[model samples]
Target chain A: MTFWGDYRGHGHPHESSWTMLGPLVVLAVLSIVGGFVFNVPEILSGMFPIKEATENGGPGEMVLTGISVAFGLAGIALSWLMYVVNKDIPEKITSSLGGVYTLVYNKYFVDEAYDAAIVRPLVQGSESVLWKTVDAGLIDGTVNGMGTQSQGVGSLLRLLQSGNIRSYATWVVIGAVVVIVVMGVTR
Target chain B: MNLLEILIALPAAGFLVTLFIPRKQEHLTRSFTLIVSLLAFVLSLGLVTGFETGKPGQQFVDNVVWIANPDIHWHVGIDGLSLWLIILSTFLTPIAILVSWRYIHKQVREFFAFLLLLEFGLIGVFAAWDLFLFYVFWEVVLVPMYFLIGIWGHDRRIYAAVKFFLYTMAGSVLMLVAIIYLYTLAGTFDYATILDLFRSGRIGLSHTEETLLFLAFFVAFAIKVPLFPLHTWLPDAHVEAPTAGSLMLASVMLKMGTYGLLRFCIPLFPVAARENASWINVLAIIGIIYGALVAMVQPNMKKLVAYSSVSHLGFVVLGIFSFTQMGLDGAVYQMLNHGISTGALFVLVGMMYERRHSLAIKDFGGVATAAPWLATIFLITTLASIGLPMLNNFVGEFLILQGVAQAKFAWTAFAAIGVILSACYMLWMYQRVFFGTQGKEPGETVKHHMPDFNVREWLCVVPLVVMMVWMGIVTQTFLPAVSATDASILDQAGTASALARPPVPPTGGITHGGSLHAR
Candidate 1:
C-alpha cells in the first residue's frame, strides 16, 4: 500500500523530512542498481571472491532471473487487474475462501513465527541466563555473600567493645590461667 | 635535593599548604590546590624529559637517615617500572582536583587537602625504595582516602571507608610484621641492600621464611589489588567513593598493588613467586571472567566500571605471573593503561552522575544527543577500556597474552576470554547509556541539565584522552624504560629460566642486560 498504492493520509505534507528520507531514498536506489554498478565479490574479495563463469551463475542464472522477473510482473499485473479494473474480484475471492483469505490477509502468521523462533528466546535468555542468573545470581551473589559473612564475624567481635569491667577481668583471668597451665605442662 | 625528591616533596608540601588554607576561602583553597597539583605534574614532566631510557637501574636517587633507632632511611628513586607510574600519579592528581572543583561542596578545603595528601602517599608508594619509608607512605595514603570516601561519598560512605581501611589494614599489619622480621634478620630496611645481601649470600631465607614473608607483602598488595576474593571491599568502596576518590582508587592507587608485585614480591621471593604462580594465575583468570560477568549485570555505572577494573587488573596479574619478559613489560604497561582508561571512565561516570544525581544505568538514555562531545570522549574511552586496537590497552593486553602464551598456552586461552568479555560489558554499557532513545526516565533531566564537557571538564579529560592515544601509538617512547626495569626485576627474581640461563656473553653490564630485555 505504501509503495504501489497512493499515500492518502489526511494530513498536509510539509517539506519531506530530508534528513531521514534522503538516505533511505539513496539506499533504495542503491539496492535497485548498485549491484550492476559495482562488483560485490571483487570489492569484498576474500569474503565473497569473484567466480569463474560456472560459479558466476552462467546460463542457470539467466533462467532463474527470468523466472523471478516473470513471477514479479505477474503479481503486479494481478494486483492492478483486481484493484484497478474489476474491484469486485477481490471481494469474490475473499468470499469464496473466507478462512484462508483471513490467514493470508494476516500475513501467514509470520510475525508470530518470528517472535517464537528468534525474538522471545533471545530477549528472555539474555535477561534470565546471562544477566540475572550468571552475573547477578552467582557472581554478585558470591561477592555480597562474602561481605555478609565478614560483617557477621565483625558483629561477633564487636562484643569485645562492650566496656564491661567484670567481663574483661574474667577474660584476663582466663588468659592468665591458660598461660600458666601451658607453661607448667611444657616444663 | 634530587628531582625525584622534589617530585615526592612537592605533593607533601601542597597537602600541608592546602590544609592551612582556611575553609572559608573556598576559591583560594581550590585554586591553590589546583596550582600545587599542576606544579607537581609540571615537575614530574621534567623527570620524563630528562629520563635516560637505555640507562639501567634507579635514576634521581635521594637518601636521608629518617630514623636512627630503626635504621630507616628516606631513600627514594624511580626506575622504568616506577617512572611512568609516578607520572601517572602526578598527572591524575591535578585532574582529580579539577574534576572535583564543583562536585565537592561541603568541606572544600579538607577534601582538596586529602586529595593532595592522597597524591603524597601514592607517589611515595611508587617512589620509596626503602621498606620502612614505603610502609610510612603506604599508611599515609590510606588516611586521606578513608576520609575522602567516608566524608564526600554517597550514602554508604562510612561503611565503605571502614571496609577499605580494614581490608588494607589487615594486609598492612602483616606486612609490617614481615618488614620488622626482615629488619631483625638483615639489620636494615634498605631494599637494595637487602637484595644485594640476598644475592651475595651474606643473608638468606630458608624456603619457609621466604614464603611467609612473601605472603605477608603479597596479601597486602593483593588486598589493594583487590584480587579475586579479597576484592569485595573494592566494589563497595568504589560505589560509595566520591568522584575524585573513585578516580584515584581506580587509577593510581591500584597500581600500587601490581607495582608492589613487580617491585617486591617476585624479586624478593622468587621461589615463592614461582611456587604460587599456578594458583595465582587461576585466581587471576577467575577474577577476569567473574569481574566481566558481574559487570555485565550491574545496574549501576560506577559498579560496572569497578568490576571492569577487577577484570583488567587480572590481566596484569596474569602477565606478572607468566614470569616472562613480555609478561612483566605488559604488566607494567597495563598498569598505566588502566590508570588512564579506567580513570577516564570513572571521570565520565562522575560527570553523568553530576547531571542526573543517580548512578543507575536505567536513569540515562540517549545521552549522546544531549552531550555529543562528552559522548565522543566517552566512546573513545570505552573503546580504550575494551582493548581496541590502536588504543593503549591493546598493546598491553597483546603483550600479556603473548607472554602468558609462552608460559602456559592454557592460561593465555582463559585470559583471552576476558578480552572478549571486556568488550561485551563496556560496549553494552555504552549502547544502553549513550545510544538509546533520549529522555526515557531522566529525559527532562538530561535534556536540560546535561551539558557537554565544559571548559574545566575538557581540561581534565582531554589530557587523559590524548594520553590514551599517545601511549597506544607511541609504545616505544614508554616501553624501553619499562622493559629495562622489568628485565632487571626478572633477573633479580632469579626465575628458573634465569637461573638455568647462559652466562653473560662477554659484553657485560647494561648492554647485555638491555639486549636480553629488548625482545
Candidate 2:
C-alpha cells in the first residue's frame, strides 16, 4: 500500500503483492500433497522418463543423484531470483556494458603498438638514410640530373631548328659551292 | 574443345578479337572487348563445374605439338594450383571493365582493349604447362600493366609505371636465362617431363649451376612477390595506379612470384629448394612482421593496403617453404583468398576514392550513416582480410599455421604475431572510416557534397559480398580439389615421416614402438 500509486486498484483488498504471491505458495503445497497422495512418477523424475532405483545397495549412488537434483533445483531458484532482480533495471546499467564492448569493437590498440615498435622506426630510418641518400639522392638525383642534362642538350638542339629560311638556303648554297670547289680541285 | 586448350585459346581469341574492334565507334569497340572478356570468363566458369576435386593431378589436359622444328608444343593443363587462379583472373576482369565503364571515359576503346589483352596474358600464365610458354606468359603481363599504369594512373604515373616495368623486366631477364639453361639440361620445355626428370634424378645441374639458376628464378619471383627489402616499388605503383590496376597487382600479380616458386623452383629443383628452404623461410618471416609493422603506420589507405600485400604474400611464401601438405595447400588457398578478399577491398576503397578523391585515413569518419551499404561491405571485406574464422582467409591462414607448426615451432610462433597484427590494422582502419561524425571540411570538391555509392557501386559490391560469404562457408569444394596435391607435396617434404608416428599411448598403457606406422 505504501508503494501503491494513485491508480484505481490501490484500495482493493485483492490487488496486492500477497495476492500474486498466494498462487505460487499454493502450487508448492499442492505439489507436496500430490507427490505423496498420487505417487506421481513424473514428479519423481526430474526430466528423464526412467524411474529412480530404490535398492539400498550403496549410499554413494543415492548421494550423487540427490546432489545432482539439489544442484539443479538450486540453479533454477538462483536464476529466477536473478531474473526478478534484473528485470526492472534502467538503460544506464545496461549501457555500462558498452565500455568493454567499445574496447573490443576498437580491437585493442595493437596497431599503435606495432607502429611504435616497427613502422615508425623503419620509415623514419629509411626516410633519413636510405630514401633520402639512396632512393632520392642516387636514384632520383641521377634521373633528375639526366633530365637537367637532357634540357641542356634540348636547348642546343633547339638552336638547330630555329625558323630561319634564309639560313637554310645559305646552308644549301654553301654545300653546293663546297661541292663545286671539291670537284674543281679534284679535276 | 578440351578445357586446357579452351583456357589458352579463348583468351588468345579475345586478344585477336580486340584487334578487329573498329576505331570509329569506340563504344562498339568497348562492347567487343567486354563480350570477348565475358566469353573468356564463361569458358573459365565451365572449369568450376567440370573440375574434379578429389583427383588432384592435372585434368582437362590438352598437350600437342605446335612447333615441329625445335620440339616445342602447345602444352596446357589445369591442376589445383592453376585452377582457382585462372577463375580469379577471369572473374575480376569483367568487374574491372564495369568499374572502368564510367571512369575511363577517354580512350574508351584502348582501355578495354588493353584490359582484355592483360586478361589474356594472365590466363596464359596460369594455364601454361610449358616452361618456355610460362615464361612467355610471364613477360606478356608487363606490357599491359605498363600501359595500364602509364596511360591512366594519377600523378607521376610514367615514373611509377617505368619503375614497375623495369624492375619486373630485370628479374624476368635472369629468369629467362635460367629457363633456357633448364631447357638445355632437360632437353625439353615440357613442365611435367622436366619435373619427372628432376624427381627421378635424371636431370642434374652442377651445384654452381643449381645456385645460379635458383638465384635467377628467385630474384624474378621475389620482385613480383616484392619480398621485404625489394618491396619499395609497390607503394608507388599501387598509389599511382588506377583502381583496377591496384586491385590486379594486389590480388593477382603478387601471387605470380609465390606460384613461380612452387611450380618452377621447388618441384623442378627440390634439392636446391630444400637446401635453401630455411633461408627462404627466414626472409618470409621478416617480410611478414616487417610488412605488418609498416602497414600499421601508413597515413595513406592505398599505401596501407599495398604494404599489406607484402605481409599477406609473406604468408603465402611461408606456407610455400614450410614443405608440408598443409603449407602448400595454404599457400595456394592464401593466393586465391588474397585475390577474392583483397580484390573486394580495393573495389570498396575505389568507391570511397570516387566519392572523396582522397585515400588519407584521417580524411573522413562515420561514413556508415550516409552509405550504410558501403560501410557494411567495407567491414565484411576487412574481416575477411583480417582472416576471421569461417571466412576464406581464415581457412588458408589456419592451414599455413598448421603447416609451419609441424615444420618449425619458432617460425609458426613468429608468423602468429603477423596474424594478430593483421587484425589490429584492419579493424583500426575499419573503425576510423565507419564510426564517429560523418562530415568533412569545406572547399574539397569530393568531400563537400560527397554522396554515397550510387547504383553502380552497389552492383559492384553485392557480388563481392556474396562471394566472400559463399567461398567462406563452402570451402570444402575448394579444399577437396587441392587436398591430393597437398598430400603429394607433403610426401615429397617427408612430412609423412612425422605423421606416421603412433599417437603417444595413454597413461599406464604399453608403448607400441613395434608397429609405429600401422595406424
Highest-scoring model, lDDT: 1
Give the docking tier of candidate 1: incorrect
Worst 10 residues of 2 chain A by lDDT: A1-10
Candidate 1, residues B1-519: lDDT per residue as tens digits?
988888888888988888887779999999998999999999999999988886877888887888887789888988899999999999999999999999998989999999988998988888898999999999999999999999999999998898799878989999999999989988999988887777777777877898899899999999889798678788889999999999999998888888898999888887678777878889999999878877877889999999899999999999998878998899999999999999999999999899889898877878898899999999999999999888999999999999888788889899998998888889988988887754464334346678888899999899999999998999998999999888888877663324423453656532211123323
Off by over 4 Å in 1: A1-187, B437-446, B495-519
User: Cα lDDT for residue A148, model 2?
Assistant: 82
> lDDT tens string, model 2, B1-519?
686676667766766776677767777776677777778888888998988876756888777876755557678888777788888888888778777767776666777777877887888888888888888889888888898899999888998998788778878999999988888888888887876776566666666777688889988999899776667778888988888888788878888888888777766554556667777888888888777766776777887888788889999988887777788888899998988898888888877887788888877676777677678778889999999987889989998988877777788899998999888778877777777643364322222535767886777777777777877888777877776666655454343222222343564211111111111
Worst 10 residues of 1 chain A by lDDT: A48-57
Candidate 1 whole-model C-alpha lDDT, 0 to 1: 0.86
User: How accurate locally, in lDDT, is each candidate?
Assistant: 0.86, 0.76
TM-score of structure candidate 2: 0.72
